[model samples]
Target: MGKITGFMEYERLEEGYRPVEERVKHYKEFVVGLTDEQAKIQGARCMDCGTPFCNNGCPINNIIPDFNDLVYRQDWESAIAVLHSTNNFPEFTGRICPAPCEAACTLNVNDDPVGIKSIEHAIIDKAWAEGWVRPQPARIKTGKRVAIVGSGPAGLAAAQQLARAGHDVTVFEKNNRIGGLLRYGIPDFKMEKWLIDRRVEQMQAEGVTFRTGVMVGALPSEGPAAKVTNDAKETVSPEQLLAEFDAVLLAGGAEQSRDLPVPGRELDGIHFAMEFLPQQNKVNAGDKIKKQIRADGKHVIVIGGGDTGSDCVGTSNRHGAASVTQFEVMPMPPAQENKALTWPYWPIKLRTSSSHEEGCQREFAISTKAFIGHKGKVTGLKTVQVEFKDGKLVEIPGTEKEWKADLVLLAMGFTNPVPTVLEAFGVEKDARGNAKATTDFIGGYATNVPKVFAAGDMRRGQSLVVWAIREGRQAARAVDEFLMGFSDLPR
Candidate 1:
């Protein structure tokens, strides 16, 4: 390993952020990346641990120590190579992934973890700047056609792999953009849309075709209630897709958001996080929204304490909301986790996102009982303090309270993938309603329906972008093997 004693001499260095005052005014990436020298120093902090648990901690099993060592030795080209070998998009994961790898870092048991994520961000950004990143088209054509639904991380990953394996790959997206959630669901403040566009260009150069605004199920005449884009368009039918392509892959995301079925849910001001989030993204993309969900001069109440909720808070702040309050049903987690008990595994701890740092009123162990509204519009929320007793959530007496709220966003996570699409393919679903496809080597990602495969959130329910990438790549290998009777692609 380069710089064997570097860990003893150098301390971990973190990436900086733009000032809250300046950053809150606009929605753009604010993370200040490390300079070359600083990145090398951070990379040197990686211990020469014989067993790299960080590898297992990463969803895509990135060779962290190898890349760290390469960066330490000033081997920029090799570092990016090692990075791209495992991860299709380090830029995405480096920005948004929770970095479980750092949590499993041996140094994190006491001292700060190696700045692995930041180092990765630096390497990839450098690689792009130096023209080291380029499209690698397949050397030969396999002449087999493949159809992939949804253009999110999973579908994109799978398409890239299959295209590189010499198969004809076409990705179908319901939205007018190539990126599924990445284009519309995620805010630009987290990751710029240009990054996704660059990747799409690379994918197209690699021989993958992207068909946007083409739904794979029954075509809608007026679009669904939750139209991704304001420019309404007709949808495509499942039968048309099946008849056109030799093989089909269901990689659509879990779009059916979990709803709060409490009273007054039908209030006009109450909306799902998806309903609000995509509008902001569309506006950021320079679209003229008819009625944007503005938090301006309004007391915003974001229900459910998760990434989506945090996103709402940040967007609301950007919208100049009068106030933002986030509610969590479960009790607040400890500020720090007991490392001794949860080492090498993801631990439950209080995570303060950049949005939280900006400004937010966080309430824990609070449950919303009813949405107080008037004339079909929400005006306030009635909530109660909750306690866990005998494995059940119990409401505390005399803890009922109502808070003024002009707008309510339900940021609770997704329950399952939309069943209509899966039903169109006649794919079997698991108990959780996810597509029932095993990752075993024998059958790979094949579901009950022959010639059809599933991966990512469509198969595993809601998960991180990194996990989706891993699943997509693996599923591509499965498909390639099934189609060619043997696959040379990496697993």
Candidate 2:
């Protein structure tokens, strides 16, 4: 760790943010990073606990304490090395990760935890500015070709790792550009797309080839992905990929958005969160969109209370919606958590995102009964309050209500990967319809199809970006071992 008594002396300092008024005017990243001095102090706060649980808590198992200590000692280069050893994309995780590492910090048992994510952001930002981030191309080519379908975090990670391991890696993306969700699903206000471009450049320099506008396998349905960007100039069949590449990895994210199949579901004004969010992202990226979904001057009703719903609220506010209201089926959680009971675990407590603060009315324990529409377009919503009774949701009597809603966005969550892609590969699927792959230490990331592998959301379903990176890095190692009978890549 850092200073032995630093935990008692230094207070936890979070990163700053731009004023909401100025930030809402445009779609750009608003969170301010800590200065070098502030970051050093935060790093010093890491205590010398007998066991470092932050590593275990982090999905990628980053060497948190060592990096904190290195940063405290002003060894910026070594700090980044320690960070890059386990995690591939600290910048992405630094910006959006929920930071379970801080929750699992030993000092958090009784006091504020170390600012691990802030420190990581500082380290990587400094590394890039100081020209430390460079291509590490393999010295000797292994003469093996690997085709990774999807250019999201997982696919990018796997491609980078495999390329560095002396394999010829080519990433296939269906969209006009790479970065799958990072390029489309995510709003620019949360994370600028330039970050993805920078990494893509670095990956190219590292001998990783990227093929955009090339689709792999067949799309399951046009409805689920109608608003999604899939500007594929050509389609590559499963057999074509298998015959051309030594190995294949499916890292496409869980693309299907969960829907609300209630009355008036086919209404014109009702749309999935993906439909509304990606269009704005395209507009921000200078793409011409025709009849794009707009929330301007409309009463927007968003279903679901998770991050996606919050994103809808923020985007709607930016679009100058007349009113924005979010609904969550589950009961509202307490504002605070019992620290003693859940010190080392993700606690169940109220998590109001920055999007919510921008301005939106949030409703909890409310379930949508149907959409009220006029002229085949949504106009309002019908909902009833619900409560769990003996482990089952039961609607409360006489709590039904209707509220004006010109536009409705479904933001519940994704259930699984696109089934058609998996079916085309003939890969075994889990009960949840995700690509079936065991994550065991010896035989991890192996699908039923020979010479084919799966990782990230396609294998594990929707999850955090950090988890996807972990699966991708681990899957790269598995694929290397399968090809070479032994792998030198780190797990």
Q: Which 10 consecutive positions of candidate 1 have the poorest summed lDDT?
A: 223-232
Reference-based lDDT, residue 240, model 1? 73
Models 1 onward score TM values of 0.97, 0.98
TM-score of 2: 0.98
Off-target runs (Cα >4 Å) in candidate 1 are: 219-232
The per-candidate count of clashes, in order, stands at 0, 0
lDDT (tens digit, per residue) of candidate 1 on 220-241: 2332224333232656666777
Can you write out model 2's per-residue Cα lDDT over 235-311, one digit (the tens) per residue?
A: 99999999999999999988888878898899999988988998999899899989999999999999999988998
Query: Candidate 2: where is the Cα deviation over 4 Å?
Result: 222-227
Clashing pairs in 1: none
Q: How well does candidate 1 match the true structure in TM-score terms?
A: 0.97
Q: Which candidate achieves the best TM-score against the true structure?
A: 2
Q: lDDT values of the candidates?
A: 0.89, 0.91
